[model samples]
Target: MKLIFEKSVPGRCCALLPACDVPVRPLESRFARKDPPRLPELSEVDLSRHYTALAGRVHGVNDGFYPLGSCTMKYNPALHEELAALPGFAGVHPLQPQHTVQGCLEVLARAEALLCEVTGMEQMTFQPAAGAHGELTGLLLIKAYHRDRGDAARTKIIVPDSAHGTNPASASMAGFEVVNIPSAPDGCVDLEALRAAVGPDTAGLMLTNPNTLGLFDRNILQITRIVHEAGGLNYYDGANLNAVMGVARPGDMGFDVVHLNLHKTFSTPHGGGGPGSGAVGAGALLAPFLPAPRAAAAGGGYAFETPPKSIGTVKAFYGNFLVVVRALAYILTLGGDGLSEASENAVLNANYLKALLAPYAPPACAGVCMHEFVVTLERLKKETGVTALDVAKAMLDCGIHPPTMYFPLIVHEALMFEPTETESKETLDWAAAQITGILRRAAEDPQSLHAAPCTTPVGRPDEVAAARAPKLRYRFDTL
Candidate 1:
């Protein structure tokens, strides 16, 4: 496959436009560029084929069993897409008069009500664009709430070592000093470490319920209680909410703020840099500090309502409105009862897959998992020089996308798998077979595992070089 630019032919045409009928407008002299931009010059057929080929090269939930742990790569329904594409919602303008877009406002207002109910939150804002964005927004709310009450000393946010990398990053970006707490041997929060970490400067604790290792922290309530007792707000990461949705909730566990990944848990198109909705939720304590332009009901009609001491607009014109539409559709379609079943099924599928693969690839934790599981290849790596990466690349050769590799930091040579609820038992069995086959191959022919993924179009590149010196765009000189 050649680069699109490489296929460009001089003066090649696509007939994308008609001759201008109106008066030709010239760019202002200051805004004009010295040279015309060079782009891929291809016929319409060539362009279509290029993208089609590109799409085939990628692996998505539609393509295979995508068990990327902590990232719920489930199969989102097509109905949600149709709902998002509805003209009434998709065509609405942010600058339109509030009274004119009642349907759009109602969509958000209804979504807020239902989502708040689901999470046990008093209020929510569909203002943050992504999960990490929501984390920053939620933290800012905590910061604003404390400062509003004259507790400015609440400056440090406690995060468990098992938290998503974005947790500490979001806290730091929100201008809060982050305090790291270690996880206990059982993969839950180390209670004593958390207790020792909290003090007068404590602002909050940020964590997910079922952590990255896919074990639901048995001490979740106790963990949140310890923070609250120490005068710190609890911020739920909500990344693992897929494991507990409807079955459990962060608000019930005493979290003050939470950021739900609508793209992940709520059956929306995810990955490849998304138009995602983080959709921050808050308890009564932090509701007033939610981001502004929140949808509300005024009399019989819906309208935008800013909270009293809001953190202000997190994103211009309510974050990723169409994404919210898709998410809201998912919530409504499943409803409460269906959501509980989905969560339970998610747990069941993960545990089933873990059981199938446990003999070949041992899980990092014992007993049943919540909605995902981790397998460590430390012993395998030592015995056969076949690291987790080797097994992952080997799976790619088997026409399967590998689970998340070397993550959560604690487990050596880690591979985390989330067999989302959408996967059929047959699919799980097949995936397990493929993985176990790869593990067998890993030991039988370690050299082949070292040079795994022989079937992929591109295999075994200088990863470090690619990362450190990425060639992000085409170079005119190369052309």
Candidate 2:
């Protein structure tokens, strides 16, 4: 595919501008720039065709089955998008007077209330923009709570070894030393290790209920209890909340602070570095320290109110508002029972996929997985020199997006799969077949697997160079 700039014609224009109807001010005087911006020049038809071609090359949930684990690349409901796009919701400015944006405030309040009911948290702040942002906000809340009580020694945050990479990163960002406790043989938090890790210096424990490996900790209650017993708060990372939405509540499990990924679990189009809302919910203990401008019911309408001891605005305004709007629409559409059923189906679909892949890529942990499961290709690499990356690349030839590769850090050659509730049984069966065929190729013809993804426009890109020395912007010299 040619770069848009390479297709540029020197004198071509895509659109015509009406002759200036008012006195024109020089843009150069307002904003300083050394040279005119170099943008592609093309006819409208040429530009349209260029973008259409690019669109065909891109793949998404709408394109086909997306089983990216932990990320939850499930099919989002179209109705949610339609509702969020409503002019009243989409056009309302964050800086608009609270009285004028009653409808917007209502959306926020209603969304917060629904999320509170689902997670069993007392209060919620839609201030954090993404899951990691929410983690940071939750940590700040914990810090404020502890500091207000004159508990200055609390400085360390305990995280499980199988936890998301963001868990430790968020803790460290919040100025808390991270203490990693290894997972037990059963792929759950090691009870004794957790007990030993928490002490006077422990500020909190950051955990994902169904961990990155997709194993739900049976000792979740005891895990939170141990942390609380040692005077540390428990922070729930809602990355895997798709498995237990409406089935379980983190607040009931003794967590003091919880952050939910509205983009992941809720019906929001996410991924590819996009708009995510990680609304933080808290128990009564940390409610006072929540982000400012919290939505509250005032008389018949809704209004924004700051908590008495607010953290003073984690975000400039209320969080990715449209994302929250979409999430609210999703919750309203599903209702309570439908949400539970969605979670159940998500778990069932994952287990079914795991069963099919067990022959080639054995699961990292034994027994039932939640909405996602991790499979290891270590044996395949040893036997056929076909690593997980080879398998992932081969998936493109099958016209399917690959599962998350080499993640959770603990598992070797990890390929995490999450076949969300949206996929049908037939789709799951087809994906299983494709994966099985890829594994067969791995064993029978390893060299062919190395030269994988022949069907894609770019075959086997230099991934290491792409990551380490990215060529993000197009340059005339490169072409």
Candidate 3:
């Protein structure tokens, strides 16, 4: 394949425009550039075919089964896209007067309300743009809530060993000491250890129910109780909320702060960086510290209100408003019962796949899982010299995107899979069969797995060289 620029022909145009009808002013001499900009030139057909071919080569949830763990890469409903693209919704400006954009404001309010009802929180701030940003916003709220009460001494946040790396990083950015509590052998947080770790210095605990291991913390009630007993707040990392949506409420479980990844559990697109929304919800205790301006009802309509003691604008103009619109569309489409069914089916698919792969996996503590599960390849590595990386590469050959490998850090040779709710049983079975077949082949000819992914456009580059000599920016000199 050649670079798009390499195929460019001089003076070729993809589009034609009529002469300007309106009177135009001359450019300011100071603002004018001395040289013309370098750009690719191609015919309309050339440009169209090039991009269309590129699109075909990329795989997405719409293209196939994406069982990538932690990241909920599920099929986004096409209706949401259509709704988001509507001119009435899409043309509205963020800085437009409140009266001019009441419908858009109402969508944000409704989305916030739906999230509050689903998570059992009092109010929500849809200002955070991504999951990590949401964590920072939640932590800031915790800090503000404590500081407003003159409890500035609360400066430490307790995170678990198996937590997403963002948890600790967010805490650190908020000027809190991050204390890590280890997970027990059974993969739940070490209750006794957490109890000992908490004290007056503890600001809060960041936890994910149905943790990264895809195992729900059986001691959740007790865990929250322990944190609250020490006068510290509980922050729910709602990344895995899909496993327990209507069945459980983080606020009811004693979580003081929560952030829901709308793109994950709520049927929006994921991956490729994003246009993502991570709405932060808070219980009554933390509500006053939410970011402003919060959407409110006024004069038979909606308006923005900055609370007296708000953390103050975590994002510009109520975060990504378009993503919020998509989430609102999703919530309205699913309602309550449909959302519950999604959670149920997500758990069912995960457990079914776990059962299918159990015999081939490295030793795991016996039990039922939630929406995702980890299967270690330690034994396979020891027996056949093949590794988790090899298996992931082999999965590509079978036309399936690989599960996240070597994550959660605790599990050796981990292959974490989250099939999500949308995949059919036939697809799950095929994935399982492919994984099993790869393992069997590994036992016989380990070398074959070394040179895997022969079908892809590029196979097995020298990763270190690629990284060390990254071609980050385009250069005409190089061309």
Top TM-score: which candidate number?
A: 1
The 10-residue segment with the lowest total lDDT in model 2: 25-34
Measured over all alpha carbons after superposition, the RMSD of each candidate to the real structure, in angstroms, is: 1.4, 1.8, 1.6
Show model 3 residue runs off by greater than 4 Å: 16-18
Candidate 1 C-alpha lDDT tens digits along 226-311: 99999999999888888898888889988899999999999889858697889999999999988888899998999888899888
lDDT of 2 by residue, 14-128 (tens): 5588878999877766577878788988999998899899888889899998898888888888888888889998887888887999988998999999999999999999989
Better of 2 and 3 by lDDT: 2
What is the TM-score (0 to 1) of candidate 1?
A: 0.97
* Model 1, residue 363: C-alpha shift (Å): 1.1
Q: Please give the CA lDDT of all the candidate structures.
A: 0.90, 0.91, 0.89
Scanning candidate 3 in windows of ten residues, the lowest lDDT window is 359-368
Ranking by TM-score: 1, 3, 2
For residues 256-354, write the lDDT of model 3, one tens digit per residue: 899988889887887467878889999999888899988987899999988778999887888988788888888888889988888899999999999
Model 1 misplaced stretches (Cα beyond 4 Å): none
Q: After superposition, how far is residue 34 of candidate 2 from its true place, in Å?
A: 3.4
Evaluated against the true structure, the overall lDDT of model 1 is 0.90
